[model samples]
Target: MDVLLERKSVRNYTNEDVKQEDLEYILRAAMSAPTARNTRCYSFLVIKNKETHKKIAQIHRAAQMILEAPLAILVVGDEDKAYEKYLPQDCAAATQNILLAATAKGYGSVWCGIYSNEERAKAIEKLFDLPTNIKAFSIVVIGKSTDNRPPKNGWDPEKTKYEKWK
Candidate 1:
């Protein structure tokens, strides 16, 4: 529960590299997310090269923070492996798991959307040489954070409903 509360989007990061064990732990958590029809159709691309990060930053405006992080994980979905309609949902769950797991492991992380924009998606696909069947879903930048801001309380009773809309 505390980890959930602490899971905030951290954009600024330190120079320290994330431990390999911690990276594996986060990836394990990502893979454990619930998938539609148990397809487990997501693939993870771990980007560590600064040059690649620079290229991504050039393409994704919101992903400029990714350049500061030690690593970024790109979650992709394969149309051939996933039920087409549910691919986004499965990929989103996996992306959320990565953020939560990174927080649990005492790392800061931020999720950068990719699939929502067609041009950005196409650029990313071309940059990474991803196959036509595979589509970029989201990118999670992870590293030791320099930002120390506390998490904001987001509970809102107005957004909740009972059995039906009143």
Candidate 2:
């Protein structure tokens, strides 16, 4: 619970590399997220090579932190098993899982959206050779952090609804 509140989007990182076990655990957390209709169509590609990360960052300007983080994760939706109505929901849920898990493990990470804009998204599809069906949803950059920023519980209690009418 403490981890949840204290988890922040960390952009700067340390020299140490994130452990393979930790990465695997993070993936496990990502997969544990609920998917609409249980389609589980989300796919993830973890990039750790400094050179490749740099190239990816170059392609996607919004991902400047990719060059600094020791680990980067691309979460995509697999069109093969995709449900048109819920693909975006599934991918977004998975991304959130990865972010929270990264924080829980004492690693700081940030979620960068790529598929929201056509031009930027097309760059990812071309670079990864994604199928026409697969949709890139977001990027999660992971590493040891230089600062500790906490997560915010952003909600409005006044927005609550009643059992009957407004």
How many backbone collisions does model 1 have?
Answer: 0
Task: State residue 131's C-alpha deviation in candidate 2, in Å.
Answer: 2.0
Off by over 4 Å in 1: none
Note the clash tally of each candidate.
0, 0
Q: How high is each candidate's TM-score?
A: 0.97, 0.90
- TM-score winner: 1
Question: What's the CA error at residue 22 for candidate 2, in Å?
Answer: 1.0
lDDT of 1 by residue, 5-103 (tens): 889999999979999999999999999999989999899999999999999999999999987889999999998989758999999999999999999
Return the lDDT, model 1, position 14: 91
As for candidate 1, its clashing pairs are: none
Looking at candidate 2, the ten consecutive residues that score lowest on lDDT are: 147-156
Candidate 1, overall lDDT? 0.94
* Candidate 2 deviant stretches above 4 angstroms: 153-156, 159-165
* All-Cα superposition RMSD per candidate: 0.9, 1.8
